[model samples]
Target: MLDWSKATKYSGILQLYRNLIELRRNKQKNTRGLMGQNIRVFHTNDQTKVIAYHRWMEGGPGDDVIVVANFSTQSFDSYTIGFPNSGTWELRFNSDWKGYCEDFTNKGYSTTAHEGECDGLPCQGNVGLGPYSLIILSQ
Candidate 1:
């Protein structure tokens, strides 16, 4: 068992913070303050993963950020995202691969809720995103 509060752990993301781009067999971890940057990423372990939470780099100037979530769930290529101020956002990427929208209703994301981004958009503090899907938000 490793300590997540002591030091940085690369067990959950593709890029360790923002420096390295690949994960060695035995060594891999990410750090804090790595909330910005655009780079290639590849991280996975069996069926479980560390990238549990989705983020938007907080509130600031819009910089291009690509997050590829390789989890188990349905995804949307088109939807709305509410910014900090109070406006709906547009989707730039979505799941092109199959096997993403399974059990979405069971997970509470029924088609009616996802009816053309008409559903309530997530606030900045609680942004909604897809699983195992690549998301690119640029400005």
Candidate 2:
């Protein structure tokens, strides 16, 4: 059996789950895009073991969300990926945050979409990715 006592402590795995679950279900924070059905896979790199996708409810600034996951052990300082439109994207969640695990490097940040073509999209942005980590971004 798992040790519930240890998990209930601050900055433990349970807290991480609570944070993630709260964000995914938060309506007041405009994170409901994660709960929407619209999704589009925009980027995928087999060699790097990375994939990126966009999720939206009605699509637009407040309802759009981008998710990137790194499945490899290698981390990237800046991985270029596509965005549906040009603007700012906020880094809402990073799985590598030290709050979840003391050893995590916490590599991930917000990015601004520039006028460039990437993964067949008109706008592109660069973001950090930690080893075996995932990140969520929103407009």
lDDT of each: 0.31, 0.88
TM-score of each: 0.27, 0.91
Ten-residue region with minimum lDDT total, candidate 1: 106-115
**For residues 1-139, could you state the per-residue lDDT of candidate 1 as single tens digits?**
8465744343323122221232111122221113533233323334433132223334333422323343555443433333222332233333322223332221112111122321133233122345544433322
Highest-lDDT candidate: 2
- List candidate 1 segments past 4 Å from native: 1-61, 64-70, 73-85, 97-122, 125-131
Candidate 1 CA-lDDT value: 0.31
Q: For residues 18-126, could you state the per-residue lDDT of candidate 2 as single tens digits?
A: 8789878964575678888999998999999999999988888768889999999999999999998788899888998888889888899999999989998889999
Off by over 4 Å in 2: 1-3
